[model samples]
Target: MRRLFRLLTIYAVFARYRLDELLPDHAASGIVKFFIRLHPAAWTASTQVHPWGRLRLALEQLGPVFIKFGQLLSTRHDLLPEEAIGDLANLQDNVPPFGEQAAFDIIEAELKGTTEALFGHLERTPLASASVAQVHAGSLKDGREIVVKVIRPGIETLVQRDLALLLTGARWLQKIVPETKRFHPVQVVTDYRHILLGELDLGQEAANGAQFRRNFADSPVLYVPEVHWNLSTNKVLTMERVYGVPVSDTQSMLAAGVSLEHLSELGVEIFFTQVFRDNFFHADMHPGNVMVSLKDPQNPQYLSLDCAIVGSLSKQERFLLARQLMALLDKDYEQIAILMVEAGWVPQSTRIHEFQNALRTVLEPVLERPLNEIEFGPILIRLFQTARRFEMQALPQFMLLEKTLIHVEGLGRQLYPELDIWEIGRPLLEQWLRDQIGPGAIMQTIKRNGPALIEQIPHIPKLAWDALQEMRKLSENQQKLLQQVEQGHLKQLRRDRIITLLGLIGLGAGLSWGFNPHWSLSWSEIPLGAWVISALGASLILTRLRSNPDD
Candidate 1:
């Protein structure tokens, strides 16, 4: 009954927002028409509401789960319209907290102790709250200030229940809707399910945070909070509490004399460093999870939180992604098309000319804008959408990267509206690409594996001899197989010849019986067996000629 009510409320919100306008024009009649009519504002273009606006409003009304999904969807500019993406970007994840008592209960249960034993002082009120969890300010028994994050009571059950509902809707949409299969709604839900479930495990998030801290340990641009493992569990987390201005608090940052330009550019640098240098990145980089330090406003470093979602790519994916980005920056659609095929993103059989043309068609307009005016994230997303038309399969790893890129760029633009992202990112990417293939990399590889290489050097001669022996045996087997095939061919040829000779003799006899004057046999006197022989003989002769045209 709860699920049914929630589902009905979602439909009501959809109708209230006139989201059904997103349906195809053909759907305005028939069984779909009744549902379409449920929308209060349908066909009211004078209302000054765009489809994207309605979508954003509807998601916001649907609750935190839907809002988060919208936030994820907003990042994929390649998959949605500009207006829609823009509207969804405004979706916020803030939701009302369940209850302070419930949070305390969860922490007590997870820690196997009363709050008084674990902390010298535990705040009855939460410091922050979101859909999945809430955080409380507390002081350890040892006098260190920390924050205790407790998973919302019964959140697992709620998330699973809502996810099942989402999957049902996705299945229904795919069945009844047209042109939506490309979005792969069901697959989106499945992927979200995995990520959400992973986020539910505080242990995994602690590991991610710890790894991120190590990756940026020596760096001056970003700060990752330290996780208190001794006090952490699967459903509870205790971490060092750092005070800084929220990255979204630009006015406060400006008041503190923070250099917005440097901060914006540093965001780009940090992103590239994490991806190319460390190969591990915090995927959920929304403004809510980021903070700007006040210690050095001139050389501002970012503080990141909520490490539940992180991402990395395979070596091949990193290479291809870098090359593709460079190609796009250069406006070399042809190179991008070639790379797509080479990277196996598109089928090898995809026509290069057509693919190139398609890429240029999608990218030309985006590239025509000024370097500072163009959005790097959206263009990259648009490339994915265009590639889809050429039957390019979705790369799940890239999805995380793409989402992170959108967050980084969006936050950067907020800090400095005129920021040239390409200018900031291009040099870093180029340098990384060069370092990957340069002589220095080779020297480093050899130096790292010097011992293994030296140990294998002694076996080189024996390995070469074994390879030669194997090749020799393979060659001999190949020759024997070819000989057998030729012998079989000759035997088949001889058999065919015999069959043709017998067929010809039968044909000749049939002709003599029917037409030859010496045989004195008319057509009426001819035996049916003779006709059958003649037909069979003709078929055999044709078959032999077709098989060996040289004959």
Candidate 2:
């Protein structure tokens, strides 16, 4: 019954989006066509809005869960066509805001103080409203402007229930369609669960903000909002409010004397710095979340918001990813293959040559275009599809990192179409490589690993002795196993040889008795085939006794 309800809800969403028109009928995918035919009345063609428009509208009506799904799907340009992906990228939480009193109640409860006590000046109206939370502009007691973000009443409950429903449906789908297990749908759900839960805690978001701020601490190119530690809570966040025109407002930015070219370059710098230097990035980077600092026209600074969904890479992953990108840039498909396997995105059993051919198929066309013309989204999607053929597992870390980078790149393109992110980013990458591989990097590594190395010095001889003892045991076990196989084979050989010897003795005695005309039975009375069988048995036993174990 729950399955039916969820399926019906999905069908309704599909109908609302009028996706039936965009999809093929009998020619579409088997599952898609089946769904379409079953709900002919539920879906309609585009007589009103474009398919993309309708999709956005449909996702909007479906609310947060579906919106977030669409948002994630937007990053997967490889799966959805460009048009559909564009529409989905536009999806956001535009649902009506919860009441201001509700927001006030949250702030008061989470901060353990009244709104007045928390903010020197508070607004009855929210600065912005969204599905999960709403923001209100206020002032701190020190007369500094701040944005008080409060979670909507009952949202956590709603999100939790919806996530449970999604998990149940996903598991049901996996059971019904075993092939989808290849996609690791369960892991995707778990990944989404982490992001959603992290978003629920305002303190985590504050921490994310703090990390970003620290990463770009001395940078003149970006401004991460300062988290108000004193007044922040798990459900409420008070941040140093930033005032600037949205990066999307090209005219306003131009009017304010911000340089679009420099702004675009700075955007790339921020991305490389986050990924290569900091290993942390703001994952939810929509246009609204980005703003331009008006004070620096020639060298624009970015003001980023909503750090609930950030990305991080492990040290090993970062190393492999950098090498992978560098290999792709150099057109060395073999290195790309090696690095991907090293990253564990591909299995060790993956045929490198075949993987290279698949990669070259998608990558050659992409590299043909100039770096500025590269669409990171479609490239990722193509790479994902090619890797999928080789049974690649999308490491959640890399997938999210790639998504964030694409988001940053896409935002750059939106603001400045001719922006060459790679141009601005390559120097940074080179410098980062130098800092990592140069003498300084070696010194740091030694510094970090030295203490542990010294601690192991006194135990080295004893540890080596222990390891040698273990090696001896392992060798003994292998020898025993080999001997057991040899013994079993020899036993079979011995049994055959013994049976043959007995048969030979009997056959020789019978033959001699017959030739001498002293046999007990007449030739007519004896079985004629018995002597032939005895002779054959003797030959078989001789062969078994001479048989080799390898054979």
Candidate 3:
């Protein structure tokens, strides 16, 4: 019954905003328009505001989930109209704060103590109120300034209810419009559900913050405030209070003598460093969570906040991504297409030349533009959209990274219109690639694993002997199977071939061990016993192959 009510509320809001008009002309839209026109609210709905403005207002009225949806939509410049994207960009997490009493109740309950006992002084009002939580300024017992972030009470319930409604709506839309399947609305909502729920856990956010602080402990590029673990809980987080001009507050930052050019470059540097060097990065880098430090205006630094959502890629993914970026810079569309298929980002059967042509058609014009005029965010979006034509699947792991890149690019451009991320990022990426595959990296890998290899050296002879014994048994078995095959038992021929294949694999393993680079001993210096094993294994494999060429 409650869900039905929520559905009705959503419908009323949709009608009130006349959102049906926003839909493209289609059979589905015609049906929706007919129903909306029949509704009494639609007749009385205000027409004074632009449709985009009405849409934004309706989302805000629907609460946090919808407001966040609007924010996400704002990044998709290709999908949304310019005016709609502009309006949605204005959707901020500026929800009104809950009462002061409720805030104190939550903090006390989470910390297991009264506000007065836990702090020297706690504010009666919130410093900032966002969709998921609100922050209140306070001082610790040691007179250190801090901010207590308290998750709004009952928000989890509200989020879950809204998510369920969203999922239903998504499924309904997909059913009504089969073409929407490519967009994967259901999976998108499911991912958003996990992200929203994760934001509800302050403990996770605290851990993320601690790790980020440690990553940049000595760096001037960024600062992550200290997390007060003792005073934090899943419901409440306490951290050192930081003061800086918001990155979006251009006038204030300029007044403080902050170099916008340096600041914008630093933003790009911070992103590359976090993604490539540390592998862990704060995924939520919107202006609200980022501020510019004033300690040194000439050498500006970023103060990062709200580390609840961070992103990291697997080692293989990082390597492939670096190669892909390098290829993009070099205009090697063929390599980009090859890497996408190799990474399983696209189907294995994808026609490489065709894919390359598609990429070139989409990206050549963008790459032709001046470095300062190119927007990496939209380019990535276009690349993914092009890949979708060849049946590229959804990449849930990259959603946060994509969102962060868009935020970073948007913020960098806002700070300095001429910010050339390509200039700032190319060298860092090149250096990182060299470090990953150069001789130093090889030495480091060997040094890290040398001890274990040495420890296993003594057991190699025993393992090799065991393998030889197994080979002998298999050889004997193959002889019998081959004899049976000669007697017209064709089934035994397949078994003989299987035994021969196994023996070949065992011999290959022994040969690889003998030639392993970590072994300091030369071929002449190798123990006689090891040489015997290698020779015997090689001779057996050769004899079998010579005797049965088909096998």
Candidate 4:
């Protein structure tokens, strides 16, 4: 009942935001019309008017979950309407801290020691705080500086409960509402749960940081702080302290002697290198999380922090993304559209001609401009909007990729206003394309799999026997579920059967009265007929509601 109440509260809030107005227009009118008739209110047109502001406001009202969702959604530049994407991007992670003492208590308890023992000194003041966690500064025993990160207390329970509630609601929508199948609400929730789960583990983040550090150890372009593994826990993270001018502070960067144009071009090269060469890029390198190293001003290096979120593309996804980017650089719109469906990024049923036409309409206007002026932002939004028409399910990983890319692009332009991203992106992507589609790739794949394939050949018989056993078990489980559902149906039918029979009898009597109305038509016919009709309608609706969809 509490869960149900919570759900209704969510709906009530959504109603106020005018999200309900976004529901498809007059869809399934006959039976659906009566069901939704109680709620005559419509989705707000305000979402379109100053969409960005409206989006931020809606996310605020929805709380942390929505803020996080907005953050993720902002990354899918290729999958959202321009206004919607812009609005989501504008959402600030700014939120009030819980309390200084609450943070200290968590840190001390997590380390299982006093502040003095863990560090020479610890600062109570937080450098930054967000909806999920807070960060503080401290000095180690040897006077080496570090930062202490502590998860807000009681956060896990609240997050878990909210996630559970979300899952339950998603399941209900998928099962009870046939119309939602296309939208795949349950799958969306599943992806959401996995993302939340990833965010919950600071250990994973610490490892991500360490891996990033390892990958860039020999590079001069970037520096990642080492993870103090001993000091780090699942809820608490300790790492080497880093300092530099914030990436967003352009004036400071310029004053520090960094050549803006060179710095920006370098940033572009670093982004491509990370995605293609390293295959591991910091997916959350927002301006807030990045800084510019001022030691070598003219040849600047990027100071990166906050490795809590990272993204990696599958070999196939990376290849397709590379191919699509290359195609855009080559002015091959049809190739880009073809890769969309070929990569399973869009539904196969989408017509190539229609998809290509839609993309061309979006891209041509932008492409007519010089490469130096073209921004990836508008291009990404158009791509997503067009793909969505073809029923693409935006992957969570893709969102992170786009977010990082946007951050890189914005940072680059600030350093060098005239930098042509296409010039930087094209050659790198083309080389990657050659590497991926080359004969060497085929030989490598075969060589890597050859040994495994040979070993598996010897176990084929045993593997087949094991598979048969699993199939038998699965078949039995299905039978048992079927039986259980049948019993439940029988129980329900027993209860409704009496009501249905009484309803029929009442209906017959009402019909008889109407016929006898030939002798004397009276007001009794109206009441009798109404009751009979109500009862029959109620029975039918209940039966439809009660029956299991699978059954």
CA lDDT for candidate 3: 0.86
Better of 2 and 3 by lDDT: 3
**TM-scores for every predicted model:** 0.85, 0.83, 0.81, 0.74
lDDT of 2 at 48: 76
Q: Highest TM-score: which candidate?
A: 1
**Per-residue lDDT for 100-164 in model 1, tens only?**
88888888888889999888888989898888888999888888889988888888887787888
> Candidate 2 — worst ten consecutive residues by lDDT sum?
24-33
Clashes of each: 0, 0, 0, 6
For model 2, the stretches where C-alpha displacement exceeds 4 angstroms are 1-53, 177-181, 337-366, 369-378, 381-393, 434-439, 458-503, 517-551
Q: How much lDDT does each candidate structure score?
A: 0.84, 0.78, 0.86, 0.77
What is candidate 4's lDDT per residue for 228-341, written digit by digit as tens?
988889999999998788888889977777788887877888888889888998888888888888888877888888887788888878887887887887779889888888
lDDT of 3 at 432: 91
Please give, for residues 1-551, the per-residue lDDT of candidate 2 as tens digits. 65467668767777656676665333324576467557755545444788777878877876787678777767654345667777887786777778888888878887888877767998879888888888898899989999989888887876776678778867865776676677676777777888788888889999999988888887798888899898998888989988888888899988877777778777888888888888887888778788887876766789888899988888777777777777877889988887888767779988888899889988899988988888766677778778877777867767677778787887788878988777887778778778878999999999999999999999999999999999999999999999999999789877866766776776675566445455567667665565675566566556655664343
Clashes of 3: 0
Lowest summed lDDT window (length 10), candidate 3: 73-82
Give the worst 10-residue stretch by lDDT in candidate 1: 38-47
lDDT of 3 by residue, 429-448 (tens): 99999999999999999999
State how far residue 126 of model 4 sits from its true place (Å). Answer: 1.4
Off by over 4 Å in 3: 22-37, 46-54, 76-87, 174-176, 346-354, 384-394, 448-466, 469-551
Better candidate by TM-score, 2 or 4: 2
Of candidates 3 and 1, the better by lDDT: 3
